[model samples]
Target: MSARDWQKSSFSGEGNACLYVSAPDNATIRLRESDEPDTILTTNPTALNALIRNAKAGRLDHLSKG
Candidate 1:
């Protein structure tokens, strides 16, 4: 995808590192960190949605605490 194709998350803080995503096709979604745009993660719509839900619920916040 091109630079204009990726969209930044609205929850990202002002002038801080952020998360960006791009879905050029229905079969896949791409994720990248603003600080390291070269590294991208490819995932499906279903799995990505689940991850977003879990993250918003804090399920992925403290994995080492358990």
Candidate 2:
């Protein structure tokens, strides 16, 4: 599929350091930091949903600190 448009999270407004995502197809989700446009990471919908749920539950904050 063609590269899709990347959009930063609305919660991360006006920042150079933020997560950007391109949802080109339902089967895959692409993600990259705004500072690293050349490198793209892909994940499945199920894994992405789990990560989102973890973030909402504050499980990711522990990883960020260490």
Candidate 3:
């Protein structure tokens, strides 16, 4: 794929510790952290939406605990 226009949330407020996202194609979504640009995480729209929904519902909060 060619270079993508990655976007970060405005709430991130200019820092190298935010998450960046890009939709290089209709079937794929890409994510990466500013502090680790070389490492990317890929997912589809459906899976991404599921994750977001679960997160907002607090269903994934247990994963963050030790």
Candidate that would win on lDDT:
1
List ranges where model 2 is wrong by over 4 Å: 1-4
Better of 1 and 3 by TM-score: 3
Clashing pairs in 1: none
Q: Which residue segments of model 3 deviate by more than 4 Å?
A: 1-4
TM-score order, best first, reads: 3, 1, 2
Per-residue alpha-carbon lDDT of candidate 2 for residues 1-66, written as tens digits (9 for 90 to 100): 234588777777676788888888889899887777788999999999999999999988988885
Q: In angstroms, how far off is 5's CA in candidate 1?
A: 0.9
* Superior by lDDT: candidate 1 or candidate 2: 1
Candidate 2 backbone collisions, by pair: none
- 1-66 per-residue lDDT for model 1 (tens digits): 689999998878766489998999999899999889999999999998898899989998898577
Which parts of model 1 have CA positions greater than 4 angstroms off? 64-66
Worst 10 residues of 3 by lDDT: 1-10
| Candidate number with the higher TM-score (1 or 2) | 1
lDDT of 3: 0.86
Q: Report the C-alpha lDDT of model 3 over 1-66, residue by residue, as the tens digit.
A: 334589885667676778888898898999888888889999999999999999999999999999
The TM-score that candidate 2 achieves is 0.75
